[model samples]
Target: MDIKENVKKFIQSELVTDRKFADLQDKDPLISTGIIDSLGIMRLTAFLEKSFAVRIHDEEIIAENFGTVESISALIQKKLP
Candidate 1:
């Protein structure tokens, strides 16, 4: 699977259990929509760090970086190489 797919899968399988969010869109607002909170972001950060072997710095953990699946994927992509 790819970055967006992995993000969507992780969000669905871990953060949320609602059927409505099973097909989370890439542009969906994860933070503003309440799908992901502060704690949720931390969990997501940990997951991303471990899963992708990328180190997310403190300055990078912002709404712009973790706003949606697409944004998160972009952040991960930047950290990858």
Candidate 2:
């Protein structure tokens, strides 16, 4: 599946919210939208690690990495290589 599709599914299934993350023309700010928060970041990170098979270091878990679906996908792509 494509990155957007994977992101959409991850947000839907894991986040348990059919947010407009996939529909927005601009990057959806998950934190600002209340789609995710500090605690939610943990869940997102765990999901990304498992889904993308990437090891995220403790210091690497930041808003820049999980702020939006696009950013998260980019991080995954970076980690793949």
Candidate 3:
């Protein structure tokens, strides 16, 4: 699957309880929308680490790095090299 699709699936399975994450389009700001909190952020980072086979350092776990699905996808792509 593509990055956006993978991210959508991850959010649906990981965070959404009902149809919450479904409203969250690719451009929607995850943190700003209150879809993710501090704990959620940590969980997402951990998921990315395991899912993408990338080691996410403590310093790299920041809002700027995972502001949205697109940003996280970019980080994953960067980690591949």
lDDT of 2 by residue, 1-81 (tens): 977668767676767465455454327787678777777778877877888888989887778877777887887788896
Per-residue CA lDDT of model 3 for 1-81, tens digit only, reads 976778768886887665756766777788777777787877877887887789989898888877788888888888886
Instruction: Name the top lDDT candidate.
Output: 1
Candidate 3 regions with alpha-carbon error over 4 angstroms:
18-20
- Between candidates 2 and 3, name the one with more favorable lDDT: 3
List candidate 1 stretches off by more than 4 Å. Answer: none
So what's the TM-score on candidate 2? 0.77
What's the candidate order when arranged by decreasing lDDT? 1, 3, 2
Candidate scoring better on TM-score of 2 and 3: 3
- What do the candidate models score in CA lDDT, each in turn? 0.89, 0.74, 0.78
Q: What is the lDDT of candidate 3?
A: 0.78
lDDT of 1: 0.89
